[model samples]
Target: MSFTTRPTLQGTFGMVSSTHWLASQSAMGILERGGNAFDAAVTAGFVLHVVEPHLNGPGGEVPAIVATARDPRPTVLCGQGPAPAGATIAHFRSLGLDLVPGAGPLAAAVPGAVDAWLLLLREHGTLSLAEVLEPAIGYAAAGHPLVGAVGATVTAVRSLFEQHWPTSAQLWLRGGRPPVAGERFTNPAYAHTLRRLVEAGQAAGGDREAQIEAARRAWGTGFVAEAIDAFSRRPFRDSSGRAHAGLVTGDDLAAYSATWEEPATLDWRGHTIAKTGFWGQGPVLLQSLAILDALDDGAYDTASAAGIHAQAEALTLAFADREAWYGDSADVPATALLDPAYARERAALIGDRASRELRPGSPGGAQPRLPDHVRSRVTHRVDVPDPTTGEPTVRSDGVTRGDTCHVDVVDRWGNMISATPSGGWLQSSPTIPELGFPLGSRLQMCWLQEGLPASLVPGRRPRTTLSPTLVLRDGEPVLACGTPGGDQQDQWQLPFLLRHLVGGQHLQQAIDAPAWHSLGVPSSFYPRESEPGVLLVEDRLDAAVVTALRSYGHEVRLADAWSLGRLCAVSRDPATGVLAAGANPRGMQGYACGR
Candidate 1:
């Protein structure tokens, strides 16, 4: 792990959670200095670039939702960069390629994280950008220890560093060798960038435009140029001997401008949730919540077997709808999916028995009327039973990737910042040369064929699996939580949320308890048929319960009791006015404090 660990806090109340403790402490310090949640979050976000660069960076996209105690509504900030102006499905087809990773400049979209941070401060923050950035600057300059996780990550992605950008390889690898856990590592270049931003912010009188301009000046060009160089290097091997340096140029970065649009809102179970329509998977989460509510199950508690089963079924259906019709709301109208009446119709069609033979369908709001008794020819494979021992075969692997971090800040003033910054699964975009972050491989997550709502297109945002959530009780936020797992994010979060909210479990108990994920639905990245109705469960599940589920014809895969998609949560008890924060014991860390 090439990251640092330490925790510190300043305000009347504060909590910080990240893979790296030093980065968390950086944010805590901001709060102690009277900076609000937005300030602390911004401080954390910038520091993460230096400590957890692989998971997130200044060059990535961030989709956030913020609600100030003073303001009644949560504001949605769309930080997911859009597709390059020239990108399209036909382009990939023309190149005779099934899929391409790190699409370079051609896949680049205007980055919004930097601008989003500024917007957050302008709206609900009380600290200056310079003040917020101090911790990150200090870390970058002083250096920190490399952890086992960070070391392993660097080794795994060595090809990315060696073959992509020379500068990246030079910065991350010392003497052409990846750092081992516990080794001290420094990022002076990144440190300089942070210092520049701090100095510029101080000069700008703290205006949004001035602050953003300073950040852009520090990050934009050099980052974008390195990306272009990386693309030119052709890091990954393809089927053909010839390496393709996808279209990307320095000019794109020069012209890139982060744009702010009016946010999207949906009423779910009578609570208004904010989403940036097409940008990430924000809209999808809302749609799923709406679908679940329409089911109107009077006994939807996490402890009840029926409740868990029903929620899983509902998630499957909602995901199906997402595959068919969700995309950049800028190009498609997402409001149609929010209609409650339509969701009710969709909920009515779900059957109890497994429908093994089913295929993808067109996007129609919730559920369109299907002809009564109309039989379709598509047949799905039935779940194969393991008869030898009357036990289902279950296997689990530790699959990991970079790109994703979530921060939830609740200030003494009652303001909150629920932001999830991500990117890096794919490298930084080459088209926007020197811009530090990569464009999302989000296109790969969508169906390529025409007629689907998420079909590839230029300048359109892909349907992302990243979702930052906040749970409110009696019109006040009770919990701010989220995780970082490409598509598995929601799959992991929904269950934990139920356990904590409905099952009355404490934050750690809900997060550490056994969890399960269904493979019956389409994956956000891969588009393959014959996805087994396999449910991946943690080892903690009782053997008897596992057998019971298998008897219902569901394949089960056993995962390590401790996995990285550990849930981080901050829970507030309204009655007692007590706040508790917990980090997943499965390798991740978290902290809590109050005045």
Candidate 2:
């Protein structure tokens, strides 16, 4: 039953797995230095920003699920920034735009990743700020080998950068061309930007916590904020093929900070699953699981065709609810939507045929009010050239900043974390001269209309696609796992969860299994589109299974084997205090390290 090409790495001290090897190495270095899991994770997070610029950047946002040794309960660290005060429906419409452009200053949200990482380190880490940031600074200053995907992305958008985003041209283009794959690439300006944070921390002249606070202030109200404010007035080209100035100002940056909240949880089959609130798509997995859990166990066997059908049908229905109900606004009926009784009722909708219709049921006897954008003409412009690949990875609008990355960490102390860090890709917007990074286009997830919870509003966080998962057994965290597939983040994670928790598969075995996601719901990103009755499954499945799925009226598309997900998972055994980790082999960029 093992599909994994590599065995899971097991250790007793610490474990870290991430989308990039350098990031994984950086975190392991901290653990070797006697730092805790929190310190190791934050270190990896920063390294990912420097090494995976096409996938993420320092100006990006990260929504993480953390369980500290002191506070064993899982909680979400909300790094997803809100829209600027000046970003209003009236102004966007005045610009002659029906929807915000995906990659431009106009689509930027206040950068929140820096503050969020610092906040986590300050509260739970045992390492000094200098210690944690040293590796990232070194790589950005000296150089790191660029990956092929980044080079391809840069080449694809090279002309755009040269024609309009001159700053990006100066930073990314080496010899006026995209850097060659495996070529040593350097970003001195980004190095300086990171150095400034270190200096600000040292100037505080107190304990580690106080120094971190000082750095956070410098990022929010000091130099970083000033730089972002000055750039807001400069117009730039966007995905809409129009140039427009962004509205984020210094005050917007200064007024904002990342916060911590208890995670949304669901208990079934003796294990507790933790996820971010409706503000993210984490609960879609919860709702889907609820539907599957209510059925006879054998009916959802992932290895069999029947199981795959049940999972896909349940996800289609649940994600329809995501389109119809999930959002960041207070108007979301999260509590009622997560109720078991409601989940059972929703489960009844699953049938033999692949559901081509968008069906969101009433929760607590209230009708779902979907946004006008979703109900409008659903376009078929997919960002990816084929079913196997695309920007924002698997499921999102054709318009987006770029793709995303993920990290998972666990320590001997039982602390575990799963984090998805994305947005503000180097290709998203022009690079700030001194900061060497662009603003995030996460605001594209918001709707322009009112009434829906995801309506565009100043100071409200967008319904982000960055999701991480933490699973607990008997009220203790046992696993921290996630991936980088935009709207498919949770969709891809669902099969792994079921295979591991219920199907008795090993962590790596589960991760290596073929997976699929429905594209029937409205995308979270701008220029949203949906394909009815479409199911993208890995080609590794048996020909009979593929044909069976097609017989169910699904427009089955064969995805390249090992091309579907970039998933990584880390597990800890409370009884023996042993830690095990696994990393995806699909991209050949992910790694797991522990000792």
Candidate 3:
């Protein structure tokens, strides 16, 4: 894609991206068309599906949080599609299946993204759905350039696409091969779907029901439940051997519908942050913030080294607790995890030194502490061959990557939309005929154990890594930030945010700064279970810092400085009314614009 960077003369807005330039251009188009930030955001979301299908689409679950100038209080929209009411852990057990990986009809949930966008538009948007969707429709129909990120992703996942669904292979792979950068990629089927949505939306006159029906037609229906059934079958395999078709079918598509609920809000250290509890890892963020707030503010400044350490320690502890106790709130005591007293108790237990080992249950509760001075263990790394070259590449950990796109916008009226639409990596292999987009492989994120909290259950939401955040100063919107990195999302975001908010780094500087991550013991992904206490730092970090951390008894691995999440954000100065926007330089082309 062509790369052109120019500042917007009107109101300033920034786009951080991991997709292509066309996707970013789509959002700018919405702004130019007199649409508000929310409208532009929704438009961008739809466009990304067509331009960057490997990352996300209409069939994916979206967990988003939005802030409007009129209502400074941010609201968390549950863009997650819920598991079918008929799905259950027992069903899988009956079929003698333990784990379900990748996208399939069975992994599908009640997709809420389209409906969520409609709701946001209805509540605070200035443009019609038809208006917001025009860019996506046009791009999908006319085609766009395949930029670096899109080309790289396609090259990486081409094999999976070819083996899973014929239609997908037909669309993504040309002559049974992935296209390189600069290739013109077109999705006439997807384009037609977008056109239908626009046409139906235009005719609906803001009637949500009519618009949703139009979306259903555009995106095929009744595949969610069918996908579940396929998962219940033994030796799960589709007719193509790369996908499971029985688990997803046309009937399941008909039953799927998005739900709207009141957003969940939490007050942390006097800051009110909103997150959707209906699905995803939102509750984890809320709970983690609560635990952080319960601790001494002195322990967690954004700039101080000690503060950064404390923040990492706290997040690790919270994530550990999430793995152990967090699940579908409807089936568990989710609120208990957020209890202030419990959080304080948990924070008090974290010692200054590393724990050396993992403690399975709540470390703050009655669970015994892990052994002291535990020896580190390393496991054999598996080498998976690159689809295109047959060259072996190291698969660091087997944790399935989560695919998503994040956008944060602020309009002339001060309205802001911060959202991340995601699906765990690997869309279902077999395309559902006319749907165009693959259903999410979200079920793969769930643990296969019999008694675990995240075990499959009907209507339960997976603990997602997507976190869309909005920062406020004196009860007004100031910054909106988010990223896409599966579980690593918040882990990286927390540090970046602290650096920007507390370290006083400018927006672009904070995003451009080097970072580090800890894949502690009892690792979530495979091939590295015993390899705990390993700290992966961006190469840009001072060599001294790496040595110092190693001195503290940690295994440090150096990675490319820009190996972390893709960030997109916009900050509005309440005092000056000047909006500053910055896109991550490491990702695809992103820009800032407004009037």
Per-model CA lDDT versus the true structure: 0.56, 0.85, 0.59
Q: Candidate 2: minimum summed lDDT over ten consecutive residues — where? A: 390-399
- Better-scoring candidate (TM-score), 1 or 2: 2
* Residue-pair clash count for candidate 2: 0
List model 3 lDDT by residue over 1-595, tens digit each: 1221333223454332323456667777777777777778878788777766656777676766676776777677776765656556666556565554434455556555766676667666767667777778777777777665555555655655565445556766778677777777777776766676667555656675566555555444423334323443423233123334334334444555455455555665545666666245656566656667777775556444445456656776776665666566334455566778877876776666655455444533544222111123444332334211111121212123445667777776677767887652334334443445556656655554555556666556665667787777778887777776555566667767666765577776777667666666333322223345666677777777666566656677777766655666677877777776666655544444444
Which regions of candidate 3 deviate over 4 angstroms? 1-20, 157-164, 202-243, 249-255, 262-270, 286-308, 329-336, 360-400, 424-428, 521-531, 589-591
Ranking by TM-score: 2, 3, 1
| Cα-based TM-score, every candidate | 0.81, 0.97, 0.83
RMSD of 2: 1.9
For residues 1-595, write the lDDT of model 1, one tens digit per residue: 1111222222337665544566667776887887877788888777766666656666567777666677536566676665554556687667675543332333334455665676666556677666777777777778777555556555654665576545456665778887887787776765665666667656666575576565565444554445544554453332122234443344544555555455565555434555555555656566666667776553255544455566666666666555555566324446566677766755665555434433323344333222111122222442322211111111111112234666666666666656777664323332122333344344444444554455566656666766877666566665677777655667677777666665666666776677776666654532222354666677667777677566656676776665435556665555555566655555544344434
Model 2 agreement with the true structure over 177-275: per-residue lDDT tens digits: 988889998889888988998899899986888889999998999998999899878998888887889888999988998999988899978989999
Highest TM-score: give the candidate number.
2
**lDDT score, candidate 3:** 0.59
**Winner on TM-score (2 vs 3):** 2
Order the candidates by lDDT, highest first: 2, 3, 1
Global CA lDDT of candidate 2, please? 0.85
Off by over 4 Å in 2: 1-3, 381-383, 386-401
Local error of candidate 1 at 180, Å? Answer: 1.3
Prediction 2 TM-score vs. true: 0.97
